[model samples]
Target: MFLWRALRSEGFPFVKKILLFALPTRLGGALGVQVILAALAPPGQAMLAEDFHRVLLSRALPAAVDGPDAAPAPEPLPSPGVPPTRLDELRKHVSKSALGMEIGPFHRPICPKREGFNCLTVDILPRDQLLQAYAEDKDVIPFQEHIEEVDVLLSSGLFASVAAYTQGQEARVQKAEGSLSYLISSHNFEHLPDPIAFLDDAATLLADGGFLTMAIPVGSRCFDCFRPLSTTGQLIDAHTSGRVKTTLGAIFDQSASAATHSGGQTIGDRNYDVAQVAVDACGGMIDESSFGALQFTHEFGHSGGIHSFVFNPYSFLLIIEDLQACGFLPLLRVQEVIDRPGQEFIVHIVKISEASRSPLPLDAARRTELLRQAIAYYIDDLNATRQLQNSP
Candidate 1:
């Protein structure tokens, strides 16, 4: 009974075939007949059971492997999320419904129709003058001419009143205040002799919930790479003294460090020729002696219109905080700062009322440290992006 059960359970078809064929041929007589009968008791039933077992085993054990103990392979892991590019990150922060004004949008306005931002673009030059300049050199325009149809709003007329920075709190307020929700100044802050005053005026121009979005070039990354970072103290002194002209020291530093590039291109794209230009502008070898006899004649030609202020992200934040501490009216609060790969960093500031201005929350040292950390993170991300692009 046990033998019969084992044969049936194991589906031993080969054993049955051997018993039926070999025994009948080798042992011819009663013994061979008895052996065949035992192997396949009910011959028709044995044949049917063998066929069914063969089909069932073939379908049940489908996998091909060395043994039952072998483990199955693991599935592949998912890819990591790609980090956002500098421009992509910047675009995410841009407001859509905000009614704002962009300054010095020569041709390519930062806030365009495609962005759905209700922004009015104004340049230092009038509409006709800007068009004439564009005709001479198309390269002067950075991106698309989104601001071509925008009316020519002069910088001087944008404010209600104009006074020197030294005049204090009164000059910070505007005469013709608008109901603007925001203000944008791209690559325009460095050109101003007094950035604090400009910022103060901008704050005054904005409505209660308004903000100012600005992009300023970092000295270490732009054409001003060779120039020393402007200190907060120097900016404070310049504003207090009410100096409109660029200092002799500033001019010398700029000329000495001025980067040279081929043809007409933005300052950001230019390569710095620090070695040659530094020696020439600084008189022989570059040293403190070069600035000793330098006079402020305001005769530096076209270079005069270049950067009046040079800063890195750290220094810029320092200056902004210091200005706030100096009791500049209308209170401009730093909302966001984005460090870009090229030459500039973008800062977004909101205007708060005088009542809200008192008891400033930010500690300058801690804030500066935080900004430095943020800048480092941005640099790492940018480097990683470049490495990924250059891979293979």
Candidate 2:
């Protein structure tokens, strides 16, 4: 102990400063210096404070080797319920997964709430308009490589913007067949320069097995003439049928409807009924025999402030059956009906493949299930809209 104390006293070369500044007293300073020096200068060489004694004697040094006993490993994450190989199913799964991730950590995805309207909202909107937007914005995902041309992008007057776009692509003409691609102008189909003749030309222009997609309103009839009135307006009266009344009111404000008929094609006191006109505008480019697939999207409320109407989901189903009866088969699939946040639609996607087959036979039970889901989806969406509306 005496030798240890002596050696420790010599450790820090600055003993006087340590005593004056660090320790406050000469004796205590010397004591600290001796202690530190004793701890550091080999175990036996010790002096001064108890702090120094503990430092030298402690055996807390870490070892490099792992001990024989170790905690068990954690379990792995489970595999996804869905298989990722099928394109349609895979797309659905990926979209759902990506959407789930976008929400904040605390919230889980609840079924989308419905807005007050006629039809359950669809995932796809303003179908042709949306397509054109994607095309104009360079946002389309070209699934097949070397698309010589888009087969046929059929449309109604609503897609007039797309028609003008096709006309502008004249440079790609010759093989372009651009005009054939723009078989639009549904409201004015009857007045087209040579309506029948134009359609004939379009038919001759389309290649075999080409696909034509259009977004035309589907219902008992299409009232072309404007009936410009708010849904709650007074011009609507006792004698007018709800369908015609809504059509006339929503499509036109009094001034626009008053304009002279552009030909027989003008929306007058006449009615263009059902979706057949949109299909018919294709000339023979598409018919029951060549009809590929049909997707019906319904939205109750729209930009024009039309009163909401129930989407006849049954009507669409009937159409599908009619197509099959007409010889086209393989309805193959039906998507989970969705109700968008503020719109009304039950959009259907029908893919026609020679080898395609319907997932299950259409029957009472299935139809009931579809109706239940659609209504439930809309109810939820309506609640959501109310919440959003009430929110500050």
Candidate 3:
């Protein structure tokens, strides 16, 4: 070992770097050691080429006191792209101590009961029935083991699913400051006809600073590739018109616009090639024989079985920003929007800031800029998906 040199603190300014290393004070693996390393050259000699700083963590490191940061004002022009943080990914973000609700968690519950997660599930079918429905398929057989018990069952529609949860309205109101710390869904948010109203209801169920995590399919990358991106105007119209059931137009669009999922679809952890039927721009999806029945039934009747909305990351953010800006989603603000690489994207929208009931309009220029960026992103995403599928 080189002989240790004791340097004066005043020489630090002229020195090249300060290195901190932790070595045992004694040769025998004992833990109490705090150290600082300094390499200094003589006045006439050239400075040693070294790293500016290097710190190695060892025994007795200082503990950190974590605290929350002050909430910032809402963004006027929300970006089309908001990346993700793996540190606070879906599973990690779900608090074990607090209650969480997962909607339509058929077989694969994100946080299973065996994993010690405090999660309650809501679905249209119970565990056994869901198992029966999806059991015959060899593909979903492996995940059948993880099927959780349905905590909340919605038979008719999802518009009142939150309010219709267990323990009645009186009890919910008593704890209405927020009943759940987190609410999650997988590929289900787009199914609701009145997504805005569902979000408003979600606001009622979610506590302050709670999170809503959703893993939704990207229209550009999935079977919905041919569908038009759900616009702010369409969403606003749906919300203001009080759509309780799926509209006939929405049903027609869902069937007619769905392209083959074979292109670049991902199933179980990036597995592909589910649907092999090649089609020309989603043509012949709705047969003439089925159109009359579909139209007659879904015109003004109960038709909540199809995807009422289609989205990509940019379009999603645009809608979320518009909703928040206009006070439609008064309690929720977008926390982060990230893609899961191929077929879908995951978003963590948090109810951190509560706004007034009144709408807060954004400037015309800002709104136009956001829309322009979103359209560009949509085109780029679709083009990239096509390129990827065509690649060798």
Candidate 4:
């Protein structure tokens, strides 16, 4: 660790934070000296912390390796008679022999590098910056070692404040389409803007019969209890309308509807409805940073990091079925669902060839009845637990 006594002078706080963030980069490489020199820009021309941080990221990290070599994860891997009881157990089902591409594995990779599992890790930031991002909150990872190596820095160009970059041209720089054996993510599916687009993209990355195992936050069981469940129309509109980045409506709703679930124990802010607060403000004026409010005047990328979509497992299944029926996501099929009541649900989806395709009912009445039944899954689970807890 280079002591930045020369650069860490008293007056400039940005310098200190920038230098601290820069410390963990590939500082042993050729650009090591340049980073310090860059951080120490000419007197009046200092860059903002994020700008300087981006410059550091623009420097090369390790090249993304080709995906792991393995056979496809077993076709229709038998669902455990007893489902996994904890969120971490979601990783237990991922085939160690399978080559996997995992998304947004920020610090908690399902198939960690240390474990010797074959994975192509994709995220908004590389490993070192990921560590710096979580430096202040040490408890978030428990140990620094949990942060795994990021392989492919893929961004849907959604988060502009933090753009993902890599050294080479954006091609299949590491692996080819339909090359992966399986895909995995934990607690990431709900944050997507156009989930169908994402699923379609994921389908392209996997070989036929390859699986995508994802853990979705349960809307009713979590802080989103009062928020509206994601719909097939909303999911489709985001993709079809090309509002694939976080939408303005999403920003407004997030600012207006987000709740404090206090770790799924009690609804914290249900009484303090912010839509009323927005109305009480001047001219339907909500906060400027809100995606639906003033942020549109800025850029598309900064408008993200909002959970633009929300879902319970059942609602997700219903939407996936509808999307498939509509031929939106033609190749992906929902296979296994295991719910941990009051927490999240892990769904294992597999990619199949056209021969395996089946249409889900698209009739309005049939869809409504099915969706209502799906929504009831969460409501029933919530009421049953609440009634048991309240019983004398």
Best candidate according to TM-score: 3
Best by lDDT: 3
Instruction: Give lDDT tens digits, candidate 4, residues 214-333.
Output: 877776555565578888898888888866566666666665665553233353212222222212121334554343344542253464356788876557767876886777777675
TM-score of each: 0.58, 0.24, 0.68, 0.65
**Tens digit per residue, CA lDDT, model 2, 48-94:** 23322222211111111233211111122123222222222212322
Report the lDDT tens digits of candidate 3 across residue range 194-284. 8887787677777666778888787766666667788888899998998778887887776666555554543322233323424332245
Q: Name the regions of candidate 3 deviating beyond 4 angstroms.
A: 1-88, 155-164, 168-177, 261-287, 296-305, 353-360, 385-392
User: Tell me, what's the RMSD of every candidate?
Assistant: 28.0, 31.5, 14.9, 22.6
lDDT of 2: 0.26
**What lDDT does the true structure give each of the candidates?**
0.53, 0.26, 0.59, 0.57
lDDT of 1 at 36: 40
- Candidate 1 vs candidate 2: the lDDT winner is 1
Compare candidates 1 and 3 on lDDT and give the better one. Answer: 3
In model 4, which residue pairs have backbone atoms overlapping below 3 Å? Answer: 160-301
